[model samples]
Target: MDADETGRPARQLVVWRPDQVPAQHDVPGPGDLRDGTTTGRLLIRSLMRAQLGLSLMCLAVALTVTASFPVIAAMVPAVGRITVAGLPLTLVVLGFALYPVLFAVGWFYHRQARQLETRFTELVDPPRPEDPAAGRPGPDV
Candidate 1:
């Protein structure tokens, strides 16, 4: 229940050092911004590229596993017995289990990335003002 000099939470006291105050850059007021708009197409493109790369890697792994499961099964007898219940262990392990879990993980990652992007866009792009000078008639007549 400790309060600091400013009556803020104790966490605020941690930042009350005697050193020089951090430089305060002038915040750009709405009037100072010219043609204000949040253009994040590059960020969107980067996220898409990242997801594409992930999908490509996942496909590569799938292909490699498909080409090698038979050889592996031939080498190790235990590879044939990896079941979780009364089902064929192979069906339960590979078909019922691994793929769904992999897909869920990929989906979770994509969703989290998208949500983070949305939060970033909200933070970095503050609201724009309705420009008073936008539709004013020119001083010609």
Candidate 2:
């Protein structure tokens, strides 16, 4: 070890154990998520796939509901000619009836999407037990 003008050995500032082995295959933690480790990427990809599937399913339902009206009206010519409350049947169905169906689809999609996100958040950062001392009031003067 190098030393100052004096011939004494320099003091060691740091030390490491050569016998200690690094951790292997430990459970991924929040650090892994922030560090973008392999397991973190897999978890994220799974969540994205779930969200995408939900989106596609919702889109399919909305498209089917919207398209069915035209197909029904075409297949049954009498439906187009009918009137409801001084409005054409098509107008009543498209303007009034369709709104509820679309609204339900949208609501369902929103609820499911939120649930998926909540699940993902839970997976990434599982809830921890509250510290007993945290809630206790500190000693007063």
Candidate 3:
């Protein structure tokens, strides 16, 4: 603390926590995997792993829907019909309900795949400096 020119005490600035480290990758984080730097290798791996996880999830949902198809079909004849939410029973159970959910899950995987490819392209294609005026060290050195 210091005395103000008017004689009032001036409170000193206090910092409790240290400054936060900068992000490792421009993408969302696994949190500064070493000195707050995200490398290309890590970026590729992260996107691939995430995309793979979504694929697996979609696959699992798809399998569940497929496996239940026979059971649903068997009940249709016995029950005569069962419409749901204003859709025909057969169409609702097989085409609209089951397949749509699977398609959505698959679409999520597809979107992730596109994002990974885009990011990978950015990692591979970067500006080069070969032109003399592009700032190479002169031969005069």
Candidate 4:
């Protein structure tokens, strides 16, 4: 502490020596997005493309499955007329099979979405080495 011209004690200044400070990489500032760098845009585009692709794949699968019913009915009239548990085969497939197929598609979509989110999180905010449990297995429940 040093005395000022007014005789009041001056605050102490703390300084860090060069060797005491950890080295740091050049991280982008908050203004990087407005600075027209393509990194942010590219990441957004990649994520959008992945989502679109997944949506298209699910759409294609749903279309194929739904269209198959009509195609099968037309190509093989006997299949539609066949009885299953006192109900027409077509009615049975339409009533029972569609729900399971839809449920499966929903489950697959949820899993894929979670995976995509995990990958995105890894890209945006990578795990830190200082974290003790980063890659460690948890105890059994």
Candidate 5:
């Protein structure tokens, strides 16, 4: 079998070029976190606000859907007596309709959370250029 100079099997070795070396400025320093710049504070506040808003919206939807059942039952007793496919209307609505509303709330919450996280990530860590020599052999050491 073919072997390299060290008698090991011929395999590619990465040789980083001068330009490939990461610059010191590219890395975040301790002060970047501790400084609490206006932009950083703004991002933090924005994230908190977004999370709070989403939570409140989900809570409102859940509360409204859940509370409506008892209110309707009390205000209009006849509604409870109504039947659909041999099942009481209240039963069908409570058992089946509620599930879709809950599922919809959950789906909306998940989608909003993901979008918020993506925005936060992009803001905190700007995308860098792809490495040209990634997964490929470079000049010999």
Candidate 6:
């Protein structure tokens, strides 16, 4: 059979090797985090501040939503008079509508908190670079 029909053809494989080694940088390592060096302490304080800011933001949103309900009822009396399924609209909002809003706030907070922690972890303990010589054929071959 022709090489084309057989779905096989001769081809040379090529290997790439780097001519120069990568330059090393003095990036913070896990030891720096554990040893509480000045850099490590600064990193920890920054993380704490970020988390605190996130928490305060979430709390502000929650409090605003909660407090606005009474103000809205008082300011717009028609809203309080409205009803659905034989239930007062305010009751419906308090019983069902507010839950989803609060839940969404909580979900957002959790997702953002996880992302912050993941970024911090990557900074402290970075993945190692693969060895250039590994799994390659030796020069003797």
Which candidate should be chosen as best, given lDDT against the real structure?
Answer: 6
Instruction: Judging by lDDT, tell me the better candidate of 4 and 5.
Output: 5
List the candidates' TM-scores in order.
0.38, 0.67, 0.39, 0.64, 0.64, 0.67
Give each model's clash number: 1, 0, 0, 0, 0, 0
Please give the lDDT score for candidate 3.
0.59
Model 4 TM = 0.64
Compared with the true structure, what per-residue lDDT tens digits does model 6 show for residues 16-127?
Answer: 2332322223676555556667776778899999999999999999989988999999999998999999999988998899899898899899888877877887676544
Candidate 5 TM-score to native: 0.64
lDDT of each: 0.53, 0.73, 0.59, 0.67, 0.69, 0.74
Which residue runs of candidate 1 sit more than 4 Å off their true CA positions? 1-45, 49-71, 81-87, 127-141
- What would the per-residue lDDT of candidate 1 be over residues 1-141, giving only the tens digit for each residue? 467688775643233321233322343222222223233344455557776776676667656655667788889989887656667767865676577656765676666556655554444344333445433333331
lDDT of 6 at 126: 49
**Ranked candidates, highest TM-score first:** 2, 6, 5, 4, 3, 1
TM-score: model 3 vs. ground truth: 0.39
Clashing pairs in 3: none
Residue 111 displacement (Å), model 6: 0.8
* Higher-scoring candidate on TM-score, 3 or 6: 6
C-alpha RMSD by candidate, in order: 16.3, 13.8, 15.7, 11.2, 11.2, 12.8
Better by TM-score, candidate 6 or 1: 6
- Regions more than 4 Å wrong, model 6: 1-25, 129-141
3 or 6: which has the higher lDDT? 6
Quality of model 2 by C-alpha lDDT: 0.73
